[model samples]
Target: MNHAHSWVHAFQDRLDLAPFGSAGLALFALALKFGYDDVASIGIDAVVDGPDDRSVDLVYVDRDQRLAVVAQSYVANTPKGQAKASKAATLRQALSYLIEVDLESLPERLWPAASDLRSALAEGAIDQLYVWFVHNCPSSRNVSNEIRTVGATVTSMIRAHFENSNIDIFADDISSEVLEQLYTDTNTPILVNDKISFITHTTLSFEEKEWQCVIAPIKLSDLKSLYTSHETRLFSANVRDFLGMKAGDSNINHQMQKTISENPQNFFIYNNGITLLTHGVDVFDVPNGKRIDAHGLSIVNGAQTTGTVGTSEIEPPADAFVLARFISTKSGDLIGDVVRYNNRQNAVTASDFRSTDSIQKQLVDQMKRIPNAEYDGGRRGGVSAAIKRRPNLLPSYSVGQALAAVHGDPTVAYNEKSAIWSKDALYSRYFNEQLTARHVVFCYGLLKAVENEKNELRKREHNHEKLTKADIAKLEFYRKRGAVLLLCAAIGECLETIADRVIANRFSLTFGEKDSPEDAAAYWQPTVKAISGLHAHLEKAFSDGLKNQEKVRETLKNFSQIVATLRAPFAEFFKSVENKLS
Candidate 1:
């Protein structure tokens, strides 16, 4: 009855964040929430946790989703039947302080995050704010009530903070069970494991390799029941969630519900049918038509239709029916495509369109040759590949961002992954014929190093480990937006010296054939230290997020002169880099 998620322990060990149990859970939940493939992929600087953190453990903003999350997490010292309900007090305090109060009054550590969130909310950059109480214990009604209070309080505060802003805020109790379900959604397309049979008077069947589909009519009542049972889990593989009916007459969910009420019999013709992906299916002809049994069900499409029916206040008419297609497949490689192609509701991003580009294919092939590393180039294998964590796995977005930073533009790399893959000029700059997997290892490894150092500094800060005054100043500098990528770009400027060789071509540089990013990151550390030593240069170049390329180049030139004057005291590490080169 009392057990811990193995994945939580995995996150702890992978990031080596043991003993910081609550922080580990926070990272775990955020990774799932954001579809981050590994602990390394997460930006640890988002953690605003410390004694002075004002009950805000983490604050993560997703501009793409128009969402901001303020989370308070707890990890039990011992296994318990349920998590403490009182943990919600932490979120309550956050709502009262961070949301309701002016940003100027916040503690220095929290002020930056609070300010970012405030700007997002007030400027209408964000429309959804989530307050999550995440813990590694079973959920209880007691805690659920507390979570509700937290949600209500945050909702009230949002209005007070942004009087005319249209932001919908929610509070969620992300207990261990809920966390597991979110994890399951990433690993598989379907989470509902119930085996159920369907009967229809008219039906058609089609077959293909490792897949088959049964087309039939499904009663609206039955469809609603399935949705009511699983909710968003039914659309686990869907590209987007049910974008509930908004304040407009043209909203699809609104139309679907109205059709069901005003024209029950015409529902099938007027509305698009649903597609259900399943683990297995068995079909047999009955006296009237066909009977089919399916297991492990999820709706790949028609989430809006199903959600509208499920959430409808009035019961769906018994006579109404919706056309349904049940597709059965066990192939992971193909299901990702199935999910991607079937989701017509969501806007396909530029990354999706670029996944098929000829350059991406070559990069994908080159990356696969390296051991203990995987790069999708563009497509990250969707739901199938996210089942497990690979700390060294370089997903498409990270690679794009890293390449963009080291090549030239830290601003694009830090903010425009879509633009990198979508824009022809930008795509060619990073993914041209001159680029190789080895070069990616070089740039990506340096970026990983930057991220790791930022995390290490914050870990020590949160753990209350002793830090010298200078070290604390360094941590503060690393906290700035685009700072890690900015530093990565800084280090890339001196790759030739750091490699301790006259490298003619920077794009061809690599840490060697077998070196993983984690190991290769060590070579970049001395450079990071050297450049970061000149805090004034860093502030001048990065204070506004690498806006002026000439200013950044001047900063690097100054850094180079300082290194030459010091004779580059990092000969020992530079020698290591020289030795590792293939």
Candidate 2:
């Protein structure tokens, strides 16, 4: 199947959104642009559309990424040359209501998200603001022109309302073609198919195995042009995309921009330079420097440097040069390895560094014994580790999160993941000698069960299935940010009732050796249903924050008391599946 057909086929299973094709397009685009897990972190609040929703269909805010996405969506009932311009005009109205209106004037339903966007901007925390009109139809001159106006209009609004902010704004029509390209990008690396030839100072070539390498000094101006021409499409081989640079003295990307603006002459020596993966390269002598034409090129590393240079408001010095390392390979496995081992741009890479820990090794061995299980243990690497999905393939960071949320400190799992991997205190707290594959599966499965329940609720809404008032109430509570993680924490506190024993260390609890996370999730479904009915007790905890430890502890305590009275419902299920270590 092609991209659009594939989206139709899998949207229901993976995204839990295929019924309301038009309304769901914004989220579909958001998921395609960013990962779906990140969207879950933001919650169902991100998809706000109904009466008083105004023109905006989606509002996504990630302070950690220093980014926010506000989108309007449409899927034409009759396939047209393009979507109506009126829908595009709605983006302008959405921007005004979100930025210019007073907090009190907006509807109660839209207030929380509108406040989040404005607050993130005011604190100067957000650097990238993406305004998209996502649709299934093709792009047109009129809609494209309207999108351009939307960008210009939002820029003026920010200048007037947030004068201190230097927000980088991008406006685009996320049509089917764009979505198809984004889908294709996940697998196909070389999107910038333009033949690239540039002046080089002293070129060097070498060969090892099935790969060849070419090293040279490439002009920063030339790189800037390459980036200007292709934009983000230049880095399509990288599945993560750019995390968007922040503006501050402490920010590394900002520091890179500072270096280029202040001392361009030393950019070559100061920066780590760019690494290019290519199909072939041709070298020829030029007047002063050698010229090389590189074909099928994508940057495996140093995207930040190229992006810094490309986004510079100032022209780089004429003599400025950065070293470029080009690798040409015929072997596909080597190509994947090249992208895996070399590419490095993430907010959390410390977890991958913990791949060698003894606990992680033991877990890996233990996971192998469990059928249909693959646990990376913080050593998650490359495309295969990223895009592939299965019944119980648990990524390392998620395992860290589940363990943290179930044990204690739900906030650390939800908000402070970097600390979970980096700080020795947090690292040792979750992945210690007591940690095992079975424990990881038990905790991680509980978190997955909560997420699955939330998705099922969303699927019900999308399918227009009639829901009970209690189910509606539960859905509303689950829609809040960090609710799923907090509930995971809450449910962990009530495990004594399910286990029918006084559990000392929750980390020591285990499911059967043959059980995958899926099996554990199945065993815990009764518990999830039991907790799902008690939304009223859990709703009070979010008065503070979903990830707040104090609120989480209070909520967990209250729920434990309430669930102790309801123990009979879940005891039988846990009793049959509980695999206490021998």
Candidate 3:
């Protein structure tokens, strides 16, 4: 369908509106999303004549309290619509149904109970006016001019019809910057040009007598309701309640977690290009089952908060090894509790968790016996058995080292590494797995979150000094998906960053399993392709944000390029390593 068709689709869904009224509503909705507000339509004979045959799509009510009808010209075909499946048709079709109203009587008609409502609501001044047009199968060359002319015609009618309103009219979707550029670039005398550009130009006469027109006057609120309802029904229901659910709906998050947990094997795995150095971790969950990890870590969706826990609150599962040893535990889900604990740790301690050495010696000894404990390679690399005996000593040692480093205590500074590596290996393992998955989901969610963030940032910059909790909540939302894409993209970028000479050196580092260059490069191929697929998926999802989106979009545009840029080099790198191994 054309733009006119899709726009009308939004309006036609409302069973209560008259056909002309529905068209008017659609135009108003388009005007709202596109930044036009307070619209009024003008024309008595046209209203009586019926909007079924009118060429205009929407009408605008100026801040000055004048009414102007508008007509829009939008193209339909593969590239703009079918090629990418955009909303151009719906927007165009909706724009074609312009409504006409009387400026002198518009205040009374629009707000029947009060004529001052328009001015009172607008707070006395208006900024822009709009006119929409409807045309059928007009040639490409004539569409632009036709739109301008139709808008002009409605402007003239509105001016002659009202006589003294200071209202100015403009075409739909023309931003102030774009309009300024258009006017400045046009060939006309400075004085006349300034006065007769997009803001000032009005049609003295209509040239396209062949096209049909429909015009109606409708309330902006009704339009907003209709369009949003239409969009919710057609595209995304979540967008319908964006403001209400931005911090996120607990129900939605639960549902998402349920879906993921219910289908773990089927869920696509996304790694952060990092993994446990050793394997074999086992854990049991009643009513569910047992899980095994070759890399000593299993990734599961992290627990979601029920929101009952405060930032200061901390709780531990009775059977758990670490938190269980501390204070009395609380009942309820552990996810929110864990998040709170982490948050508090970061806030008060500036670290997420206590060092393993902080645990009592008896408890530390018991924890060490538990098989498949998560390990930190950086800290546990080569600790002596004697040092391992002192469980609570590590935290003090680590903290002391940090202080001593600043205070010039050589012994404290020398042993800082042990403090960092004192946590349970199994715990770190689970965290890595969960975080890898969360990060990927977060990246994907970021594309959708961009506009919301933009609005939030604007509000913060103008109205609030600090960002709201809701805005920060978006951080968790992004972490849930964004990390996956970031990891995959990181791998791709890494491969590209290494020059030809360093490529051989990189392949050695890339392979954890083999020293053979050939085998290493061959193993890298599938990994590269997997990362590339991730890039492709994200690029498509974020196509609207051209700059950030374009990075991956261009990278994945060609299948051959993906293979050449990412696949072949890895293959050669592996082959070279394999020869060395042989």
User: Evaluated with lDDT, which candidate comes out highest?
Assistant: 2
Candidates' C-alpha lDDT: 0.73, 0.75, 0.27
**Model with the higher TM-score, candidate 1 or 2:** 1
lDDT of 1 at 353: 65
For model 2, what is the alpha-carbon lDDT of residue 396? Answer: 73
316 Cα displacement, candidate 2 (Å): 6.0
Write one digit per residue (lDDT tens) for candidate 2, span 435-543. 8888888897888788778767767876778999988888777766667787888878877776777888887788888887787787777678667778788777666
Residues 67-111, model 3: lDDT tens digits: 333333332232132211122233333332222343343221222
For this target, which candidate reaches the highest TM-score against the unseen true structure? 1
- Candidate 1 differs from the real structure by a C-alpha RMSD in angstroms, to one decimal, of 3.9
- Tens-place lDDT digits, model 1, residues 1-582: 234565554444444343234665776776665555543444454667677888787787666556778888777766476777776766888877776777678777777677667767877877678789888778899999999988887777777768977766768998888887777667766778899788777778899878889888988888888778778878887766676776557566788888877888899999779888988888888996678788878888888888888888778877798999988887887787778668633222356667887877887788777767777767756543543556667877778888887876776776566667767888888888888888888788877777777777777877789999888888777766567877777666666666656767678777777777777788776556655665556577764445577887777667655555554666664565667776
Model 2 has an lDDT value of 0.75
Q: On a 0 to 1 TM-score scale, where does candidate 3 land against the true structure? A: 0.19
Clashes (candidate 2): 0
Q: Count the backbone clashes (under 3 Å) in each candidate.
A: 0, 0, 81
